[model samples]
Target: MSQSDELAAQDAGDSGDGPIEELAELQVKEEARLEKLFAEQREERGLDDETTLHTFFKLFDMWIQLYRLNKCMEVLPEVVPICRSRGGDFHVKGVQALAFTLWKKSQFNDAVKLFHEIEDLIGCSAALCENMGHTYSSMGNFDKASEYFKRALQCLDKEEELGKKTGDRAGILLGLGLIEDRLGRFEQALASVRESQALFRQRANGKPSSLVAKAGMSIAKILLKLALQEPDDDKRQEMEDEAIIREEENVALFEVTCGEDSPLTASALRGLGEAQKRRGRVPEAIASFARSYQIEAQKDAFDLLGIMEVHNHLFGAHMDLVKLGNPLNRASFRNYLPTVDLALDRVRSMKQDANAGAYYKVAGEFAAFAEEYQRASKLLSEAVCLFKTEDDSKVEGLISHCEELKDFCDAQLSAVRGSATANVSESKS
Candidate 1:
């Protein structure tokens, strides 16, 4: 057989073996040769406690190949001290890798510490600064995130002056736009995203890329926000129409770039559904959300935030579908109630999380749809308490609104009971 065919045959034989099993088998087969190589390398380098990290590095490599992120994290704490003791490219690569691994684990503090190490080592490059910015953004520190992102752009600009490739520079713009959006600097966010979109378009080799699609979604989302804030009816209509157009374009780009069943396409579908919901296309919105939810449900691994958001959207779509006064949809609406219940249970368990306010608000809304008015009131009340405890001034207005909603539900329950009591009294008479 040719080399390719031989490799293919070997792959075919191992295809049925699980990832851990395959790795174990390979390690067992390579033990003797690996031992000899390791001994020679240690002898050459004069092995020490710090040098032991070089051996631990192999575990991280395996974990990366297996998508075993938690395992990578477990190995990282052991690797870091040794790397700090033995300074070289090993230290540099180890610090960067540890920062990224910490970021993956959502341990933003440790990630930022390693980011500082990277900065102290060789100063910040575009990638290093962008990573710091990303970690800050994930921790909900928009101001710090924006600062680093801008610094990243500056670094990339310097690289361009030196005739370097300046690859992925547009990503800095994307990050800046996201942070700006979080800070409610809509106009600036729009400009950055538009610029990033143009750059991605310029770089695309015919096919639409994920970056382009994401930039389009950001534009659409910003437009939607602007439309909601617009005072003039005619101007608001124009903005809404533009948002709808961009949302459609986003779906098209995602379908082309990620195919229909991929997570990217599902997210695009969800965005389109949100736009359709705003346009009062209840049936279309319901269909889009159902499709997105189905696609996401088939995947075993999904971020907590994404899964919660999908469940929220699905609940809202079902509620909207029922609002159309369609009997068929009324029954189907109940089918989605269980999903929201499960999602709410998960969110309740994460009550101490930073996102607790949003999660509680979504779950409360879902409960309202299920006619569990008391449950809705309780969840909204907890959400208010969490927002207060978390010192989130940004969402004070939202907390007030949900509090009012909880009170309204309480009033509704009282009214229903009062009417039922009157009917029973009349029947007794």
Candidate 2:
């Protein structure tokens, strides 16, 4: 068989024999070699500890391929000390990898600190500055992020003048555009994002790309903000229509670039859904969010937080559908309530205690909106309990809101029960 056919056959097999298995076997052998290296006398074997340590550290990629990121990071501290002891480019490269790993793990502050250390060691490059920008942006320090993005752009400009390939130019502009948009610089944001989109499309050479799609989304979002600020109704409508079209195109691009069921596609769908929702396309929005939820739910590492956000969006869309006062929409709305409940319960089961109370509170409000008073009461009670135990003062406003919702639910339940009792008495008479 050809190599491709053999690989396909191995993938289709259920015998637990494949490239992954081969990688696993390799990892075991390499681990054994590392153990032997550690146990042997380096002087007698004429082996260098620095080289051995660096080689062992590079096994991080192997561990990552095996989906053992946490384990890889756990062992990083030990390897870091040896690299630092040796110093120079070797240590800088190792630290850079560790910093990126920390960023992937959502440890943004630590990643920023390491990126700074790299800068002190070898100065800043376009890649390092872009990474710093992303780290700061993730931490919600948009001003700092903008600074780094601008610095990265400057470095890329210098590289361009020297006839060097400035590959990350588009990404830096996109990041800067997003920061500017957040800071309410709509015109500047649009200019930067349009430039980024052009560069990305040039790089893609007419092929679909996630970066191109993302830049399109940024432009669409800016248009949305401008639409909100527009005083003329016709101009506002024109802007809104253009935004929706671009959003739809972005969704299509993401579907082609990253498979329909991929998380990236799912996220793009959510963005499209929000635009549709704003345009009063409630049903379309609901469909978009439902698809996103399905993709997130099916992932191996369940995105509980993503699922939670999807639930929030779905609940809001369904409620909007009910507001239309159509008999069919209203009838179908109750059916969605149980699905939301089940999904939120699944998230609650994940023990996201840090945000569990907030989740329950939001769920309770949605339940109350749907007139499911009893369910709302139960959820709000849970919220109160969870929040009370964990910094009640911090969530005083939330607690107050929950209490108000619970009281409203109680009154509605009482009225419902009383009306039922009166009806039964009348029947008996």
Best TM-score goes to which candidate? 2
lDDT of 1: 0.66
TM-score of 1: 0.60
- Name the 10 consecutive residues with the lowest summed lDDT in model 1: 1-10
In model 2, the Cα lDDT at residue 33 comes to 73
lDDT of 1 by residue, 1-429 (tens): 000000110111211222223233344344445446555765676444445455545444444322345656665676676677778867876786676555655578877897898789988777677777777887888788888888887888888889874325666777788787888989898898889878867866565555577777888788788778889988887876777787778777656544565555677777778888887876787777877766654432335667666777777766665577655444554556665565555556654654776777766866776677888898888778777876657777878889889998899899989999999999999
Error of 2 at 366 (Å): 5.6
The CA lDDT of each predicted structure is 0.66, 0.69
Q: How many pairs of residues in model 1 come into backbone collision?
A: 0
Off by over 4 Å in 1: 1-87, 104-106, 165-167, 231-238, 248-267, 291-309, 334-429
lDDT of 2: 0.69
> What is the TM-score of each predicted model, taking all chains together?
0.60, 0.68
Looking at model 2, which ten-residue stretch has the lowest summed lDDT?
1-10
